[model samples]
Target: MTTPVEVRYFAAAAEAAGRGAEQVLLPAGTTVGGLLDLLAERHGPALRDVAARCALLVDGVLHRDRDAPVGAPTRVDVLPPFAGG
Candidate 1:
């Protein structure tokens, strides 16, 4: 079964995705790693490139464990690299 996950993009990732947020469909219990691969495929090269350097937050916490299953009804926040001084 597939579930919907809300992906929120910020900064360059939003620019790449051409939107701040979107919904993605994934098999139940899919990992963050798997989600990234699927997302890269859906959005094409721009987002694919951003995925490499971006940080992923699932539900409000930084998700470093790509192996962990994505808990559905989830909000995934994507923050890409930024520079300011």
Candidate 2:
């Protein structure tokens, strides 16, 4: 059965998404890249690039690649590079 995935955004990413997080239902065996596309379509182009470079975390573990496998009820966080003093 398909499971719901939680997409979290931080910093500018959050602003682009217009919220801190969202819950989406994804088909089984969805890849990280696919999820990013879904988020970009929902958020917009500006957020799409950020989402592409942003780190992905599944169940609190950092995903290594875009092809990484993601399952239902997954926790995905979009983290943009931080430049602060």
- The best candidate in terms of lDDT: 1
Q: Candidate 2: give the clashing pairs.
A: 4-73
What lDDT is reached at residue 22 by model 1?
A: 94
Candidate 1: regions farther than 4 A off: none
Candidate 2's residue-wise lDDT over 1-85, tens digit each? 6788777899989988999988988888888888888889998998897886687777887775888777664577778777851
The per-prediction tally of clashing pairs is 0, 1
lDDT of each: 0.81, 0.80
Q: 36, model 2: CA deviation in Å?
A: 0.5
Candidates in order, TM-scores: namely 0.84, 0.85
Candidate 1's displacement at residue 73, Å, is 4.1
